[model samples]
Target: MRFLNFPFLVYENILKHLEPRELLLFSFCSLKTRTLVSRMRHTPTYTIFILDKPEKMSYGFVEKPEKEQILLSWTWKKIAMESENLDNRTRLKLKDVLLDCRVTFHRKLNIPTLVCRCEDVSSRKRFATALHSHMCEVFHVKPEMQFKLSLDYMDELPYTNTVRDVTFLQSSVNSTVADEFFEKFHVTRALFSKRCVPDRLLKHSCKFLEIKNLFVDWSPWLDITLLLKVKCENIMFSSSTSVANDAHLIMDNFNLEAWDPEVDKIEYDEPVHDYCEELLYFLYDIKKYMLRSGILRRQSDGSRALDKTGSYCSS
Candidate 1:
């Protein structure tokens, strides 16, 4: 009997037992199948992530049960499969575009991944974008997408709405490129960078901000002032050296009265230093000021400002 000939209950039961990848492939069978799969109650919501270097899209849950969290990955590379079974290979159509895909296990992630070998880079980008749109519609989930890419692939930047968080993986980014990127995409959620970010980029507001090994452009005071202008709920700053000095600078400039009320946590890390008395005093001073100004309600639990031995956390 044809698969669609089955009753609705039987169809749902079969879908419930199928893996995420299999269900995804089944959705491509026809419009009827796609709607059925999409309306099913057992469908999983995923956080979609896109990378440009190898040109891949990965989707997974953010929570625990790490084994089953990462359901599937799609890439344009021609990866060799562990099993040579011909059944693992198939061709799927995404709207007008047809893709040749093979089921394979990711060596490092230990998750099922689909590999599609496109003719060239342009075709790969089109396929990835089309598939991403298809998944978003079929899954009926809010666009919670993250993009990790190097500056070299700036020409291939995706639509602005599809990118909520951005991580620049380039070793170094010039001011011009950084200015162009910020001008193009206004990332609203989080911004992460390992390289030095220009002051203009730092002025943009986000929900979360994290920078590693950040060097002061002019001085620590100027850097702190720029960071203060960013309206974020949570902030983390780390440096390999001069961390203590940075902490002091932050304490001096971080005015709780002027801080965004939405902000709840602030953390700073320096690998080389322990909890110094001066740092503790600065933290206490901030806490006392917050208490006197009625900015902080809880006075007894002030230890959270300098919570760790080597790091500072204020909540």
Candidate 2:
């Protein structure tokens, strides 16, 4: 094509003006185009967001506006029927897997997107991994992956330990599925959930844990033992019923020596109950007891105190 014949610096400037979707489409034209696109000096960092149900993967800059993003979706429905209807669609080979790729505007979002339909369920993981690796190479960015997973689709888990953040959607998951999921994936940054996540999974250390909408109607899904078992740097509980009893339990049984050293903070935001007063009291008593026993020493500020675990217990 005439566009490909342009001077190297000339076309490089032109490629910089194209949006992510356009750049990706141009890269698919030929090997030289792909190389040229990859060689661009200023490439936007992309985060891969994966959804299990209605399985699809989307890539875009998290800070950018919604319309600027590009989505690559996969669907299993009407494969035989749709393939025959579209004449412009082509098969793009990603490693060993061949994807039936077509460019179409998203129905609801109305943004240009590449829709790929894999041949079988077994090939989905391979296709996703290949696409992730290809984008990383083409964009010269490290993978920053996130997943919004449904327990119903546990069999479709992403590449293990590659995901940075994971949000578990509410689903009736069996023990077997839960075990397999925890065994396969280890969340690095955070875990967010609105369901009764398995206790075994909570034992995995993460940077943040946020649980929402789980304590409605005084559900016993969350308790002191479970809270103590969570090995996270920070824990946030929101939209829950009163956790006054749980707070009391922490005061009684919380052991600095046995507690996970990684745990630095725990936050609670309850609509029905405000336990800040109780938490303050609990921290005060713990500080007094620790000071009496020399487990904690007061600083010159007379406000902050550090425990033997090197964690600040501030009131």
**Each prediction's TM-score against the native?**
0.58, 0.64
lDDT of 2 at 292: 19
TM-score for candidate 1: 0.58
Q: Write the per-residue lDDT of candidate 1 for residues 33-133, one digit (tens) a residue.
A: 99988887644444545343555666554321112255567676655555755677777678776667776787785676767764456554565567667
Model 2 sits at a Cα RMSD from the real structure of 9.5
**Over the stretch 241-296, how does candidate 2's per-residue lDDT look in tens digits?**
23343455545555323332244342333311221333234434544644211221
lDDT (0 to 1) per candidate = 0.51, 0.50
Error of 2 at 96 (Å): 4.1
At residue 167, what lDDT does model 2 achieve?
62
For all candidates, the clash counts are: 0, 0
Query: Residue 151 of model 1: what lDDT?
Result: 62
Q: What is the C-alpha RMSD of each candidate to the true structure, in Å?
A: 9.3, 9.5
Model 1 worst lDDT run, 10 consecutive residues: 212-221
